[model samples]
Target: MAFGRRRFLAVLSTTAAVLGLASPSAERAAAATVCPLALSVSAQVSPPGGSPYTVCSGVVPSFDGTPLDVDVSLPQDSSGPLPLMVMLNGWGHDKTDFESTTPAGNGANTYHWNNAWFTGKGFAVLNFTSRGFHRSCGKDPATGYTYATDPACAGRADWTHLADRRWEVHDTQFLAGLLVDAGVAAPDKVVTTGDSYGGGQSWLLALSQDKVMTPDGTSVPWTSPKGVPLHLAAAVPQYAWTDLAQALIDNGRGSDGLSGAPGDGPHEDPVGVAKESYLDGLYALGTEYGQYAADDPTADIPGWHARITAGEPYGKDPLINQIVRQLADYRSPYDMPVPPASVRIPVLSIQGTTDPLFPAVHTAQMVNRLQAAAPGYPVWTFYGDLGHSYADNPHQVWAAANDEANDWLDAVLAGSQPTTARTTLSTTACMPGQTNATLTADRFSRLANGSWTFTGSTGAVTTSSIPDGTEAAAVDPIANSGCRTTPAQSDRGVASWVFDPPSPGIITGSPVVHVTATPQGADAELAARLFDIDPASGTQTLITRSVYRVTGSPGNVQPLAFELWPAGWQLQSGHRLRLELTQSDAPTWRPDNETSSLTLSPPVLTVPVRTS
Candidate 1:
């Protein structure tokens, strides 16, 4: 399946009968004029029956003149034109992530993306490898090097654009055009969705304008050959980041400036530093796996290498580092100060309650912004298990979250209005088959609060190795039954508090934690955790957690405001709520260098309690 310039030219030449050909004979009559596409009927079968679909795999020219590998799935059983679905893969992954093929090459699910399910629901799914990833034509073919390693690819690597309006966003419009021209997808009626990297791209696609200036200072056409604008009928971004910089750094400001703060601020001019472990992974994806480092014979190549270096500790320069962070925020969905009224498409955002990577509060922030832009907009949010894993768990309901999303998409396709309900699927509060459960927030001012302070010696220090793998220790929040014996209360450099409710209470939203800590070192890191403790046995079950970091004066008591992972949990009558403040969690965040006696003020944990 090697497609070069000649192959792309062949596809372009065979485009005549693709649009409005009407009949098979007409298609054949014009076949000589239309370049034939390299398409095949995949063995993949649809669910609920054995319906089949055709897969067109090849390279399509993207907005930046780079060719991207694309997989177009069309149901052979379709009676007429179908709505288009463009799926974006997560970071460092290609179109293969959505495929059902296992590592051993056995096809377990038949279709990687459950394409058969969507095709059965009458959708044409376009799965394409984003530029600069997995066989995409961004690297230098002669040396097989990527932008990560080879300076030659600097001008064309798709990741260099990093979901920029001119690159990936523009490429989506171009791909949709190709589908439309081929008569496989309907124009002006496409739904875009994906998880993580792909999920974030969906928001960029919806918010982007129809004009773009390429990185090389050239203006490109953002429309199809027929001049049709890219029309996104709806979008469903799962676990996506609304603001990339904020998601990375523990900055006090929330997505909409109305959300929440990193520190309980009253202090002036504070900055949120980068999370090293996660940033390291993100940067490595471009250099190590993205491009062949071995192929580049140079020592300490620039670009990503230099950026990674700059990202290390207090960063390059205080002013410059802050500027870079601000730039990232401006480039993301946060740029949309007001949701465009033109984008009336229903948005169904799916988030993970226990995901440390991209916290659940981001979903609420997005929902608030979208609804604020258009009052009564059909925007919905569903909270499920942690991260991208689909493993079964007792704490979260992945099955129900998926079902609700499908139902919303089906309704939108049928011309129904978007659902206004915001739901969270939790086995504790709203069990499966239960009805009439509403979500509410338990305010901080409403809860009885107490303070616990643990002071470390002036020389006491904690550190962990870079690129920590401890995050995978507990994939599911409830997967680790042994957490009861973990003993978080008395750990070194940790402060603990306990809450015992007389009656059982259900938490339905993001939990806020306020900490006023006296800093001892040049920089500081604070992590907050909520634990469900058994009053009698003293066993602790971790509920959720959040991390915050800041750089400033060491003597002042810094007021930090942050939220734990948005979660829905039922605190049984005898169960006690424990709040623990820890100095560091290796692999999760970079350790603070300075050793200081930290004093914690009365820490308050405010959870959203469902009422009625």
Candidate 2:
């Protein structure tokens, strides 16, 4: 069943039909190659169930000589050379994790595990275990260092440092060399796509320059066997964090509910305040799978652990905290040091608006920084109401995100898309259980703005086993219950504002919320929720929510800014838009320390109402 150029082109037509691409025109049909460059492949043939693909597995030496386990799947019926796609796994996961359904039941993924979907479209996929995970090899030299021992050495080679350019990025560069030297992939036609950590790695590979700096301050040339600069065509990073510190701590909000305020918190216990249960799980995964060394039990996981235990006044009191912060700054992809303009790669960034692990703000911030550096880089985005994994949210949302990703890959590889230009965002939105009601936008306009004042509570609620955080109305709105009795607002430390629109419209894009308030105490924690209220029944359906921490002089009024998670929700005539303000939401946020009254002024919710 070997496919020549003609056969490969024919197969593409079938794939196009399935993917809803343009009808295969005569020009495309006569085309012999799917990729702009020819592929060079070396693999072992495996034919299962009468279908065939070339598979190969082996250990490749990383830049620092660490052994990396890599698996490659090549098209069995290729007419000529092929394009290469490298897929990386998330934290603590080996390459095989992508081959099956995620434990969280995100989307039943075919792209990660089965090569057929990609191979059928004429791509060679290379999946590799990151160094220090699974069968890969790397030693955390810091594992043996302690505060009583060598403090500087203890911070080196920590788990969080796993993604440092000197390590993971080097490993990727080394693997690219192997593929090119083996003549299985074109040096310039390679693209990387990964989820979470894997997604971050893809960005690292695509954005990194031809030179990498080692820990000892040594510069090494990152080049192919032929000594050419390592050139990666494009990247797609889904649910990936650009700033590790922001991802783990700081939370873009300071201690005492203020953003950019000094110190982690009054006590400096970031783990407890910033989602303890969730972060602890991540720590456990990294420790169990980090495998710093098979022989050593005392290798420090990473500098964060040491800093976390040290607590507040993070950078000053404990010198180690300062060291770890420097380490994080070194590895950070966004922020100071590395100019955003330097990491310009055409990117299709996919993020979950409802994700608890790596909140939607992370992607929004990353995009803003990237745009700031390179004003018009070709960056496209798809923000779905998804959680950490696709399955963490609703199935319908995953379908939309997954399908759009496929279309992006096809268009980019075909040269129909540009990599450096203003980001052209996709307009696709999804809602679960809606068969007839579509998620589309007509026109966008700002509904007139107003604000309200509410009391901020110092009282904290007990945590629930169910882990219900900020429930977004776009994803968790009451069903046909809108047809039943009206839902009442929670009387517990909450404020509400109701709006009646002149006409029916869809809420599209990110909605901006502005609040002017003075905290009765030193600081206050706030959560905002948007609801679509049924006029007849007064039933309220939650559409989206956002949380913020405000800090300032106890009695001084300051303006606070935050956005409700982006939504593409439908609104009908006579429906009321209600904005709910609350002081505390257990599990999602730590309740404020004091019973602070918030002297709030009129808050404005400017929704992007689709008018057409």
* Residue range 118-192, candidate 2, lDDT tens digits: 555577777777766655643223344122232322323423345666667666777776667666677677777
User: What's model 1's TM-score?
Assistant: 0.74
Q: For every model shown, what is its TM-score relative to the native structure?
A: 0.74, 0.68
Q: Report model 2's TM-score to 2 decimal places.
A: 0.68
lDDT of 2 at 295: 28
What is residue 163's positional error in candidate 2, in angstroms? 2.3
Winning model by TM-score: 1
Worst 10-residue lDDT window, candidate 1: 1-10
**Distance (Å) between predicted and true CA of 132, model 2?**
2.6
lDDT tens digits by residue: candidate 1, 491-551: 5445666765555665655567766767665566666667777666556666666665655
Query: Where does candidate 2 stray beyond 4 Å?
Result: 1-51, 77-82, 100-114, 137-162, 217-221, 250-273, 292-328, 336-343, 387-407, 414-488, 496-503, 520-523, 532-542, 572-578, 591-597
RMSD of each: 8.7, 10.8
